[model samples]
Target: MTISPIAYDVQVHEYSIRVAGPDDLDSARAVMLDTVYRDFGTGYVPRWHGDIIDLHSAYVAPVRHALLVAVDERDEVVATGALDSRGPAHPPNPRWLAERYPSGETAQLRRIYVRSEHRRRGLARRMVAALLDFVAADGGYRCVYLHTDPAVPGAEDFWRSQGVAVCDEREESGQRVVHFEIPMPVTSSPVVVM
Candidate 1:
């Protein structure tokens, strides 16, 4: 199946949803780290030197996962989302699993970030739609779920606009988390590749 690039704003652009390869890992990690620091502010500093690199490595190394990046004309990774095929979900903790999803055929969306300068241009929404389209084409995913912290503000509304419904909420390790899911279509359709 092929996917034709959907036209967003003139300044907003998306790349073909490519399967993130080894060469793209560094760029993906860079985007993720930059986004974390920007979003969390100084609080992310302590963990910055220790865990960031390894976290990115895990996302890139997993063979069963699919990572998509959205870049502007300048070619920077403006946003990224990963779909974990094998699972109860990525990050697979029992607590996270029980509090959120009920354990089923699900694909997890993670590290969905867009640079602050690029917000409101609809790039994040496009990246998500592309990811969903990709999942629909691949077949067998019953749903796609993700978690976001309420502290981010507007995060919940954005997901809601994208058809994700909040299923659960909890506070763990001092972070407030909200789980959102969108049911996947049962039948696969051929995507219009760009």
Candidate 2:
């Protein structure tokens, strides 16, 4: 999938991180496919493009889940990140995560993908912030969980920098995946001074 020539020269500072509605399927899919094939090619759990990365269930969830996209100045989705109920749903479930919690409205930090050209510009961090804020606002979600491979360059390090504690690590389907958990802060009454 080729981006338009007009997409060039757009700065990250000009982008907006917003919630993805049903209308964003095309743009989101492009980002998801482009990022996975380029970044996780040959190493991201073989034969996953259709069943997981490009799955249709992304748009089927109830009120608690959200898919976020960072649109560049040209209104093209340059990156995407999603958070959904930690259960049988889009992109399949990481079973190990269920064993850790076994209950509660836990959120899986699924599908955080940024186009190669737009990386290293703090986009990923912003996407994460948006997802966290989204979940925090949609009450009942207790924490956030995610899994990534340390073997992938900077994958674990970047996630760790976000304050997600290493919860568990195990070999799954012959590949090593590290699981992380971040306890969502309870939203209390605001503090104000008059």
User: What TM-score, computed on C-alpha atoms, does each candidate reach?
Assistant: 0.69, 0.74
Model 2, 1-194: lDDT tens per residue? 32111111223598977766567778788777666667766534544445344434643354556777888888888888877775423334455556654434777787888888888889898887767766665566677887775666777888888766554344554545676776674553322223
lDDT string, candidate 1, 157-177, tens digits: 887776665544454445366
Instruction: Tell me which residue pairs clash in candidate 2.
Output: none
- Global lDDT of each candidate: 0.60, 0.65
Q: Work out how many backbone clashes candidate 2 has.
A: 0
Where in model 1 is the C-alpha error above 4 Å? 1-17, 42-63, 86-104, 168-175, 189-194
Lowest summed-lDDT stretch of 10 residues in model 2? 1-10
Q: By TM-score, who's the top model here? A: 2
Error of 2 at 99 (Å): 2.7
Error of 2 at 104 (Å): 5.0
